[model samples]
Target: MISTHLRLSALSLAMLAATPFAHAQTQTPRQSGDGAYLLETVEVQSSADASRDGLSQPFAGGQVAEGGQVGILGTQAVMDTPYSFTSYTELLIEDQQAASVGEILLNDPAVRVARGFGNYQQVYIVRGLPVFSDDMTYNGLYGLLPRQYLSSSFIERVQVFRGANTFLKGAAPGGSGLGGAVNVVPKRAPNDPMTQLTVGGQTGGHGHAAADIARRTDDGRFGIRLNAARRSGDMAIEGESSALSMAHIGVDYRGDALRVSADLGYQDHRVDGGQPNITIDGGVPIPDAPDATKSIGQSWTYSDSEDLFGTLRAEYDFASNVTGWAAFGARTSDESSIFANPTVTNVNGDYTASRFDTAREDTVVTGETGVRVRFDTGGIDHTVSLSGSVYDLESKNAYAFGAPAFSGNIYSPAPVALAPNTVPGGNLSDPGRTIHTYFQSVALADQLKMLDERLLVTLGVRYQRLKDYNYDYNTGNRDTNFSYDEDALTPTVGILYKLTPTVSMYANYIEGLQKGARAGNTAANVGQTLDPYETKQSELGVKYDGGRLGGSVAVYRSRKPVAGQDANNIFKIVDHQKNTGLELMAYGQITPTMTVLGGISFLDADVDGDKAIGAPETQANVNLEYRVPQWQDVTFDGRVIYTSSQYADAGNQQKVDAWTRLDLGARYLVPLANGTLLTLRGRVENVTGEDYWASSGGYPNAGYLTVGAPRTLLLSATFDF
Candidate 1:
């Protein structure tokens, strides 16, 4: 089945590529008034082009975009939309030498990075809620990118949407994303021919190399791009090593009435002797962090994954003011890992760990189709959109546990003999199906413009159906008692008013939907499935765009239902967690030679009249770049990240210390006589070499500590021909 899908995707790419050339060849030269032959002008536009509905143009400093996609509503300028969003540009990705999407997101103050439970997968914390890495979307399609990690070489833009968004996109398959959503746009061929190569290395003898090549047809209607990169060797942490290889191909076509794009990508990543998360016992105090450069994981432990994914999208203009679009994407991924996360029993850091091995395979297929129309009614302008989407996933998994727990100290390490596997589930070599999920949704939205287009009002709703099935791990038999089938409706309302040419005021009320929890076997109503849970949010903000500088100030409040067993031993939705926050962001050129991008977040999270675990009160970031006046080719950049102290447990009995980090970088550009350019970049992260816990928890109600990276150096050189 996977091979058949791949063949169909390849055939579609071939047909799309052949159509533009054939159309170009059929055109003939025209005779001008002077009886001279002249070629017709061809207007070309790629997915990278900046427009109202396409990718937004970079702001004054070239680090962030002026706006980004607002779900089914397409793209809208930041000031014209009620929600808060930030689009990081490819320039920023290159300048920072970011290796993954998580690294690129470090500049966002509203976000923090954590690790998956007992594994190496990256997890993002937004507005006191978790958004799993697998939940992120690519080009507005879900479950198409690598699950554990994402390579940055083929990414063009990373867009962050704040607040509940089920009405805009759909219910996330991972059952998260109540706080925010993330969407990544893939790279596309530009207007000009290009060939570039880059080589770099970091601390601990790591080496890297990458290549990017692009070209377009003579008529400028067809374009293709290819990107590949590899990295290998030891990491900054002691005794830790990793290897990563990735490749991507992109093809696109642009015409007067139609536009199409296709992309395919592959990635293989492995990590050995990587540091593991720490879990403390309930009565034990949170221990002090160990050396930043040290690793606590066993040398025999490792994690690895391989992924293949692709997407195809097309857009057509039915008329000057009406449009329709569709997109399809699929992914197949395999992962295997051996983990030994420690549980500290005392303040002395003495811990016990046992080996746990697991394997998983995931296959995902998702697609969406929509149409939009523009018309006038009684002197008011209206833009109406209708969209439908579907997603399906099949997951196979197996696991084994070793006998006899090993002992170790956080400050001192000891090696122990490998233990024998005493318990197992399914076959590790050939796992059977364990979970199946299916989701379908239909959405409709209409935007009304009044008062000479100064006031905008948006009304939207989505009806979603969710189905999940679980199977016995050992026997591969269906478990009807643990299955669920449910449906729900999510709605949104937003209003924006332009006070002036440079300022705007906006407000919105939105909801996020998630699958309800099934009663546990110990509960009175075992196996009973409740209705879908709805997370509600309300926000108000003001935006300022001064051509060279842009900023926004917003305040929002959200409530998420919590399910648990009541006093009567009946499982039900009993309580809620309420989160309120204020965000202030500033970006763009502060002066002709200086650029700044950063923000601060203040959050108040409460559940059952206590502070929520891992939710900090204050988080802030400030990044600055300055160009040397004496040498126009020289640039210096620096950043400061600060996080306030937070509790490690729900009871607020254990607290993690506050921490700060500094990073510095410099780059120089050289121009050659042959029209080629060379760029050299050098950076130092964690310059102070501070030892601290970067984050406390990622999974719900579980506080696991992830150590911060040590001081590391990165150097790179790029040549363009």
Candidate 2:
């Protein structure tokens, strides 16, 4: 039904098409250097803050971007792209006072944040597909950033790419993000020097302080940017406290024909008295959601993690129409935690929990190289690109859990001291090697533009290989060596036709790859490593750009293989999942003083023999900002997030009712003495303090629920020097 309507809209646009012979002065929609590009026309703009590369341009809405990276194909204007994506700029991040990755994701309607399996890691669900934090890329390089928690201060932009991206980014070593990907762009030095200091506080006495400084050489040939922040205080939820610190430094050099950049960072985070997830047993009916502020986690339990990482990149132009680039990155992380998670036993909110301790260490190295060339053949413009990338990750982990179960209640939490463990996992203090994963891929693509560049077609394919290994816990000995030396070819096709200067129709077919698993020690075919499986997605969409207003409609269908155990208890990849969805999105300035941004997704998800778990049927979000016409120095903003009922059990027996949340915010800018500017911002989230289970079942073969955060009030002030 959605496709039929989309065709009608495209047909209407086609009927009003004009001649293709239009102005050649407009900038090209395509990009190079993996979405990083040189400046466009230097025409002066009226805005005080204007970026030549469009990284900070907020279309008409002043909240989201008009274009972003399309994986290996580089960046493209939103109207010309065949895929669905949204880029959130730094201006919006700071205005919302978002401190973590999870907080930043609240602006997207297509994305929902959930908790990782039995841990504090944040998980993002897009189009009913789960993408773990480990799959997030930093400046297009994987495994170089922190795996669990990352401060928003380290990032300049958040680009959300929805749909399968195997041909663009290659197979993720973590074997997640099959449906989508999030690429974080690091902060860069601005042409003008900037130094700013900020201070903030939240509902539960949480305090925050951060400083940002950036400077470019007199000739603007060399630049440096630095960011440092600290956060410590009680969280919105009762009894919970948080401590976090981070430091980041970046440097870059620009020459006539070459460019180089590097980034280094460190982060330390800890949490105490934080609320945890609850696992639901099959036989018992699911319990009602408890109060949002109730926390059962022991006061003595805590979680801590630290990470150190760096990356280097270079891009050089060999000819007027040719460019080459390379990049490399590495990360070392250490973490230890002692926490307790509860599990529901009955419908009356009865539950039980235990304390578990663990330690982990990780070393990762990732890099990529590529080349691009542009030419013309008899009036037809052609762009060809070739690239190769690799990711290697090794994890050393150990854990101990020997304490007896402690009784608890979901409605009324009872935090009790746990008996010390009698038996501890070998050397939990110094974890041993546990897992090693490696991935590599090579991709080639060609874009053909004909009919005065009104029609664009792109074809590409990637050859990918994966190798995963597992070792015995505490001991460095290899237990199951899953040496999958096999490789797969994933192809992609995309087409875009410009019916007019402001309207376009596009379609894309792409494939996704996931690492196949090996037989466990108890399986009949133990140690048998299987070849990687593939998933496919086909999408059709149309976009319209009205200068100050924009919108898009997309319909897609995808199928992916699911891993499970057979009746004989043998592990294997046997079944497939089919997902069909319709998405409608809108953004930009609806008027001179008011702007709107939002989208809605309707999904139909089904497994081979059962219903898909954890995914809701309908999800939507809307954000609005209006400037006070009378009080020109003040602005008002509001946002609402809604999710329909979702199944928490595979059989679809337990379900959650649809819920909606409202957030309100305001900002005032004042001109101070000495040409200085001061800004005051305040926000209230979850104004009603609603009690609900926000999400469920991120991990495979289990249905666990995570509670929503309590009502929160945030206030902050910034001084520009």
Candidate 3:
């Protein structure tokens, strides 16, 4: 471990030394007429804007925002906050032609995308921990978006918060996000009236179209926006096809002291013969990855999902120094799926597969209210906030397994007869209540600024309660003995100090909370519920904003308790998994015609003196965009992603090889005689067509391999009037 740490440190130092650092032109802070400091500010049309707290302006390169939300504390400038975060803007999304939230997050070196166990839901790994898609919040409220997939047409900003954030935001309802959190901001009408249409196609006969329209009243107090899109056809992988439809409407009212906004969305998505993750059987050697374009899934398998959701938010200003806000959201979703993921039993790629079918229904309602007050005591400035939130989720589910397993070869798979479900649980058509979860929390925070606003300190705490219940899948009888009701207090402390006009240093200590697991029937303490687990993190970092070029370097350490049964067969918290890492990020223009965005992360993760499964030692990403001075309307961009080798199992005997991928894109804009604008874009992913395993192990203690996407081409055209 010592030698590995030293090696990583050396690599980080070398990269930093090779990077070009530009000196920022010093400038004095603007001041009001009353001689009070006036920090940088962005004009927000209304409190119902993208972030609800006011959308942060884009940075120098127009790819990332200058700042983003700090949970209940509201928005703060990147240089002023004592935490690490990045907000991707709509401009970047459009330029990249990203179709999903996971695609947009690829630019972050600290994040890696994976698939959920036995499903196609997108999962994110941040700092060696998994954050489920359902755990993501929409407009500060949870469980309002589609559980398995989300469309990008309605998204205006994607905010990523790094490190433990239970104190900033309440504990995620899905029991994930121990390392980080992601929040999506919905789109709203802009100041100008607009109509846009887009059409696109990809390499596998897939086609798509979308429409966006927005308008505002004469007084600019009432606004409405509508977005709709559809896509259908085969994907890059052979034998796999998908169809998706989505519609969303956003309405808002901006008043003198009261602001109100509402959004409604609907989505229907289906996939046939989707590729599945490969699981390696114990004692079997990890086989080489198969051809990227090959599909081992049975053609009879399919997954279908439909969802309807909405949110209402209002903000009122009681006074100039006091503000209050409330938000409510609800969602109803249904999913049905038949899966045939195979388990490799030998080095030659021979595998055993069985048919599994499931149906699920979910109903969720969540809300939050908060008040913020600003005041001053002597020479110290203070901002205090008090907030409360509640979330409830009821899920009904049923499943069945086929009679016998089938055998196949990974190298060459052949279609088999559709298997019949024999072993059943509950009712497949109607299902039954299997799980219910309720979460409630209240938090308080205060921020103090001293030394002429050069030094800032923040302290916060949250009291959270989690109630969970489970029922027998077949009988639908409540499992009273296994139910859990628990609570915990999570707290945070952060400090930031400005060393110069454009340089700031910050440190933070925070905790993340999650519901504990109940002992299994085989354990000596069966049916016993353990206390909630709190994951703790400590971090220190320095940031530099050069106006044109900016960057940051941070070091952090975190520990999370691991639970298991001891030799006596009593289940308990036995050990703690520790992760220490260094992250370096750089973004903004590198020259007059060149812009760069990307970063690298080095991590050392272990549990019980052994390497943690699926934790990589190094990950890096670099994206560069350049405009041709000769052809002023044309721009080109490219990106490279790299990940180091990782262990796939607890014993550290099975290792998934490291991999790298490259993507390139270009776009052109044309001005027409009718005063309309037309833009065309083209992108190529996996330019080298290298076949490899993209990720290993998304679920806890499980080792599954996700095949990398094949080389593919994407093209799109947009018209604006």
**lDDT of each residue in 175-264, candidate 3, tens digit only:** 889989999988877655567899999989989999988877766677788999999999998988999999999988777778788999
Strongest candidate by lDDT: 1
Tell me the whole-model lDDT of each prediction, alpha carbons only: 0.86, 0.79, 0.85
RMSD of each: 7.8, 8.5, 8.9
Please estimate how well model 2 matches the true structure, expressed as its whole-model Cα lDDT: 0.79
**Which runs of model 3 end up more than 4 angstroms from their true locations?**
1-47, 50-53
lDDT of 3 at 76: 85
- What digit string (tens of lDDT, one per residue) describes model 1 on residues 248-278? 9988877777888899999999999899999
How do these models rank on lDDT, best leading?
1, 3, 2
TM-score of structure candidate 1? 0.93
Off by over 4 Å in 2: 1-56, 481-483, 520-523, 567-570
Backbone clashes per model, in order?
A: 0, 0, 0
